[model samples]
Target: MNEAIKGNILTPSGWLNGTISFGERIEDVAGSSSDPMLNSDDYILPGFIDLHVHGGAGKDVMEGGDAVHAIAAIHARHGTTSMLATTMTAPPEDIDVALAAIGKAVRQRGKGEARVLGAHLEGPYINSGKLGAQPNFARAATIEEVHRLEKLAPMRVITVAPEISGHLELVSDLAKHGVRVQIGHTLGSYEEGVAALDHGATGFTHLFNAMSGLHHREPGMVGAALAHAEFAELIPDLLHVHPGAIKGALRAIPRLYCVTDSTAATGMPDGEYMLGRHVVHKCMGGVRLPDGTLAGSTLTLDQALRNLVGLGLDLADASKRVSTHAADYLGLQDRGRLARGAYADLVVMDRDLKLKAVYIEGERCDLNDA
Candidate 1:
């Protein structure tokens, strides 16, 4: 079935008052701002792509069953067309169970759900001292262990502390296998950070949060990222990071993107939720531990877009941060932009930036499902 929509469409070239026609893939886009029917306040943009997602709708990804499905559905309602099922630092057995579920979801995407691209192994290979909100399962990365996990499912992204023993070699090996290695949950020095990037780590996870801070002289991991990284992820919930720091990262990293790092508490009312083995409380519009250490987040990508805009970024730049750059980081050309021959994944928003409609691979999603 062919479907067509007319509005202010964002494209690679720029915004156009256009009509986009599609089925499962975008067939055509044509329009002019001078057209008489350009009075509508709606804006059509590419569907959001989140590289980090733990869970949503009261289900934790670590729970491993129908939880990933529920998480996908809820995030899709918030205009996430695709996401990686992120896992926390846990024991091998627990990780295996979670990866099995993510693999199943990736192979079989449910209706009205965001496409589960793959797994984002966020830990079990990080610094225990910098384990912010993550459990105490930090360890070194071994190719054997990584290969074993890879067999269960494709790992599109993995966060590791570069300073861990033998991880620099591991980073090179994983990068060769096409995995997107990210630096995070570490107390690595600035020199080590640059060395990791030189070896193969291409991005920073939740920049300025768990990693080391920038110092005038010491220039820690954050300094390494600020000075050299081309890509990094930020939680745009306004709770995780200050707006000023976000602006600084914006100025530093060319492809700085936004992620939820969301837990099961997302899209749910304030309450207790599971983030792996830890019990995280969602309250006051943020998720945190009992001692008030920030856990994951309750942010959705749609809200992430709005938050970016609120931080003085124009809509086009904000859209790229929440959608395009994340896709680029994963080396996906078709999923991020709305172009001819691209997947028909996009979101329709009103003038206020609230979602009016969402399409995932040409399938319209129920906005109220979350």
Candidate 2:
């Protein structure tokens, strides 16, 4: 059955007061801001795509099984239509188990859940010294091990510290195989970061958090990311980075985007939670380790959109930060915009950005979907 939803729809070109008709795919966007078809106190926008989400609803992606569905359902409630199941630094055996489980989820994901596009391996190949909230599982990347992981599941993105031994070559190899390479948890200098970009690293992970900061003289990994990388992900929950720094990054790199970098603490009341192997405390400020290291966040994409708007960005620009840029970074052509012939993945929210409903392939999804 074809369905039409009317409201203030954000199409790729601009806003239109119209009705969007869809089945499995977007059939068309009709009507106009002046002569609208259906009227409501809702705003329609493309569903968000998160490239760096750990978990939510008290479930970690590493837990696998129905955990994937639970997390997806939780985020979908907050406007995420799809996300990459991100993994943390862990022992080789642990990593293998998580990878195999993620692979299984990807293959057998249900229609009611957010699409698990693939895996974003954020660990094991990073620099130990800059491990931030990651445990002491950092190491150099090897082609043999990476190839094995890829066989188990599609590795969409991988974070590596370029200064690690044999890592630049690994970056080149992974990039050649079509996996997005990101620089993070690194102690590399600006020069090394530029070299990584030259070799195929296209982005920075959770910019300005785990990577070195920019310096006027030395210009570290943060500087290289601002000065070079085609795209970068920022945790803009107002806790991971200051609003001023987020504004600066927005002005500097047009392609800079937002990621939840969320954890099991998200959507749950203040409490302690596990982010992979480590224990994190979630309280009034944010999710952090007992020692006060910022482990992750409880921020949802809907809140991310509001935070960006709170920073004075127009709604369209903020939506782009949460949706379009990430999709473009991942090379996904089908989503991230409300254009004709696009996937019917979308979110419905009030003018305040409070999520009211979610649609994945034209199917309304709720917590009950789990």
Best by TM-score: 1
lDDT of 1: 0.94
What clash count does candidate 1 reach?
0
Q: Report model 1's TM-score to 2 decimal places.
A: 0.98
**Which one wins on lDDT?**
1
TM-score of each: 0.98, 0.96
Q: How would you encode candidate 1's per-residue C-alpha lDDT over 261-317 as one tens digit per residue?
A: 999999899989999999999988899999999999999999999999888998889
After superposing candidate 1 on the true structure, give the runs of residues whose Cα lies further than 4 Å from its correct spot. Answer: 33-39
**Backbone-clash count (model 2):** 0
Please give the TM-score that candidate 2 achieves against the real structure. Answer: 0.96
